[model samples]
Target: MSKKEVETTGHSWDGIEELNNPLPRWWLLVWYACILWGIAYTVAMPAWPGIKSATAGVLGWSTRAEVAEKIASFEEMNAAVNAELAAADVTMIKPGSDVHSYGVNMGAAVFRANCSQCHGSGAAGNFGYPNLLDNDWLWGGTIDEVAYTIQHGVRNETDEARYSEMPKFGADELLTDEEIDQAVAFAMSLSDPEGDGTNLVGGTYDVELAAAGAEVFEYNCASCHGEDGTGDIYQGAPDLTDAIWLYGGDHDTVYDTVFNARFGVMPAWGQRLTQAEVNAAALYVHQLGGGQ
Candidate 1:
């Protein structure tokens, strides 16, 4: 075929002619189709941002609705087990039963999602958090007690939450510096009956100081902590004679605690989780060898 001469637009720059060639018909058709599709998509699905909220498309599609539907489906799948768990007494749930197995599995998931951050993934706990694996318990350790604690929480906003407040003897000036020192000496002596008194917890003490502190403890802390510092479950007091310490047993730490006080807060799971979930978590935690 002979070469055809191409026309140019009536415009030039630096003596170069500008071709007046139109785009290929197929390409033009596809471009127009894309524009139409985009307009349809904008009308059928959410696209524009409004002042307060996004424009609701004609199709009524929503990400929130989709997520809700997914959650509903999952809930439906577990509905039977959840209902059974909610009604059954956790103390009576046999270890080898189907409900028990399901509850323990579900509880593991719940603990990982909600309790892991504070109690650790293994539930071993941290310096300030109570170890769930040990026999030591600030409150009671039975499955029923565990469920109650989870339901009400500790030192939280809920009306039924477990409440206890340690008096800041140092901060409130209830005890003189010397008397506070003596009281700390007495507390240390409770934990270590055979160790040297002067070298306990990187601090020094004397027999006379401990004797004086013993009297002070009897007068002040005996109400909640018990006469021997063994603690009272009713008062939510930790056993002072044990090696377990929530914060630390160091002299400075104990002094600061006596001066200021300690308050730990836990949210009421009953408010956030279903009764089944609460029971499941309690059952799982209670069987971890810590529950009484």
Candidate 2:
């Protein structure tokens, strides 16, 4: 049979005649290749959706399976290091060993990613955060204590957590500014009293101000700070009598503390990391310094 001619609308513009056009040879070939490639790809790799599943393909490739395999390989590579960490006691992971250094590096990663929000890069906490580098710890600084704290955070509102509350000085009306200042001065005096050797050497303390501050301490602070200005650690209170200060020992530092109570918290790591990682982190923190 003869082929019927294709028809076009009888219209012409700009001296151009409109004609019915057949599929272009190049375009048809490209479209054909795409269809073939799609079929081949579906057969070789996972593709095509079903009611409840997808075609497995000849290679059986899957994103989830690939991820799992990668993770498995990584775990295998670190198997020996993890075993060593698990076998050793926390105290043994101090500053001198290879394991100690590795643990420190790992712990630093964890601290920066998770703990750095509150505990500054140097572990020097802010007004509400406790300085981890310092010896003064609310819960405890032992390797086990550090580990426990990481596992069960503070005020975590969970079963396994270290919890405590510091009175809001100004909010609770616990002490007036003048009274707080006096307490602050006394707290500072515990470490360096005016006219004392440390104060004289520093030349920062005011004699008359300290004398007035002493009275404030006697009335408002003596109860918790103690008569000799020695803080009770059992109460989660810092020892002002010591020269070392977690925040700062300067006049302004002391004054800030008195005006506003400081409440610090540590999140529990137990939920976030494997037991092995938590143990390593604890040892790492303990060895940072001032660990008892």
Candidate that would win on lDDT:
1
Residues 1-292, candidate 1, lDDT per residue (tens digit)? 9998789997999999999898999999999999999999999999999999888899999999999999999999989989999999888999989999999998998899989899999999987888999988877898989999988999998899999999989989999999898888787777876657743345445666787898999998889999989999778898887778888887788888888989989999999999999999998898789969
Model 1 pairs whose backbones collide: none
> For residues 73-102, could you state the per-residue lDDT of candidate 2 as single tens digits?
988988888788767777667677878777
Clashes of each: 0, 8
Give stretches of model 1 more than 4 Å off.
1-31, 157-159, 197-208
Query: What is the total number of backbone clashes in candidate 1?
Result: 0
| Clashing residue pairs in candidate 2 (N, C-alpha, C atoms within 3 angstroms) | 150-268, 150-269, 151-268, 151-269, 151-270, 152-268, 153-267, 153-268
Q: Model 2 Cα displacement at 266 (Å)?
A: 1.7
Each prediction's TM-score versus the true structure: 0.84, 0.62
Model 1 lDDT vs. the true structure?
Answer: 0.87
TM-score of 1: 0.84
Candidate 2 wrongly placed segments (more than 4 Å): 1-68, 76-105, 122-131, 193-206, 212-224, 242-244, 249-253
Lowest-sum lDDT 10-residue window in model 2: 194-203
